[model samples]
Target: MTEKDIILTSEGREELEKELSNLINVIRPQVIEELVEARAQGDLSENADYDAARNRQAEVEARIKEIETMLSKAKIIEDSNNLNKEIKVGTTVTFQNLKTKKEMTVKIVGVIEADPFESKISNESPLAKAMLGKSTNDTCEVRELKEPYKILIKDIK
Candidate 1:
């Protein structure tokens, strides 16, 4: 079976790489040391420290494997300077709510890099989907809302 590609922004890929490095270079060694110290305590059957260390080791190893798999399937989304005035992934867009007249700016990114708190939205989101391929001054309908709101694209960068 073929593995599906995992989309990620450059920053997202860097974060994952940092995490993987920490797990391999720091956490893995720390867990190993903990296991050694726990084993030296003796009394194999009733050793709580040894049991806890083993559990922690399992968790760390599992996370390492998961991150490795994700990295292996990762497809980084590169920022483009020439998008032909169209809204797409890696584009920071400014839009004004037609009804409320409120303007907001958000960066469209892959799912892995989507953080609403950071004003980064996933391309798969309803608002982003409606805005994708649209040029500045175009109106888009947000279908996710109960009453679909219309937004006018003000700027793209």
Candidate 2:
């Protein structure tokens, strides 16, 4: 992917660390065991289990590499209590959609840890992109949906 530094919140960083540890200590050995078991079954050419295990192993290794790269390039966004200032990465912002009159709150986080379902949006996402650097009473436009939302930042924390 892009070489930009991977920005992560504290919780996101912890999740990544946990996944990395699991991959190295648990997944790698599990894949090795599968490969060994498959090999003991029979001829390579006719062995579906062996082929599948090999493919799984390759996928796991690739994922590990990607995680390692992310860790190496991680740029953690330190927690801030400066909510009186402008909204930024690691800030929880509250906004109201002018059209729908729907109010929502979201924590702006790094791309890898974004989960819109959980109200955690990526800093690079359109909504968070519009929110960043804005202050209370400032207007922003979010354009990810079919219809763009006109939002006013009501609060930042």
Candidate 3:
């Protein structure tokens, strides 16, 4: 069996590395201290702090393993932002809805780094799917649950 490769931008890889460092250096020590403190409290049978500390330890260790696995299989995508070039992961795209006439800018990123609140959209997203491989001034149609909408790419950087 083989693990699927995780596509990530350079920025995404950096973020994951930073998080892993924090987990291992800071949070892991804190969890150990919490467990030690909880164990020091008398009866293990009725100790809520012990149970909570154990749970937190388990969660933190699991996350550490997950991050390590992702990093092991990660493929970093380097962005080449040639003007009007094809859009892809790590590209910031600006497009206008033909119907609503609203212009929006979004950064295309990997699944792990996608944050709609930050205008970073996942490459798997319908809008990003339609826009990838297309260049500026190209029109693409995005299908959603409600209805399909057409967008004209205004810029790619």
Q: Please, what are the lDDT tens digits per residue for candidate 3 over residues 25-114?
A: 999999999999999998999999999999999999999999999989988998765665889889999999999999999999988889
| Candidate 1 lDDT score at position 37 | 98
* Full-model lDDT for every candidate: 0.90, 0.90, 0.93
Q: Cα deviation in Å at residue 134, candidate 2?
A: 1.3
lDDT (Cα, tens digit) per residue for candidate 1, span 117-153: 9999998899999999999999989997578999999
Give all TM-scores, in the order shown: 0.89, 0.90, 0.94
Judging by TM-score against the true structure, name the best candidate.
3
TM-score of 3: 0.94
Sorting all predicted structures by TM-score, with the top scorer first, yields 3, 2, 1
Which residue pairs overlap in candidate 2's backbone?
A: none
Q: What is the lDDT of residue 123 in candidate 3?
A: 95
Per-residue lDDT of model 2, residues 39-136, tens digit only: 99989999999999999999999999998899899999888787466898888888999999999999999999999899999898888888888999
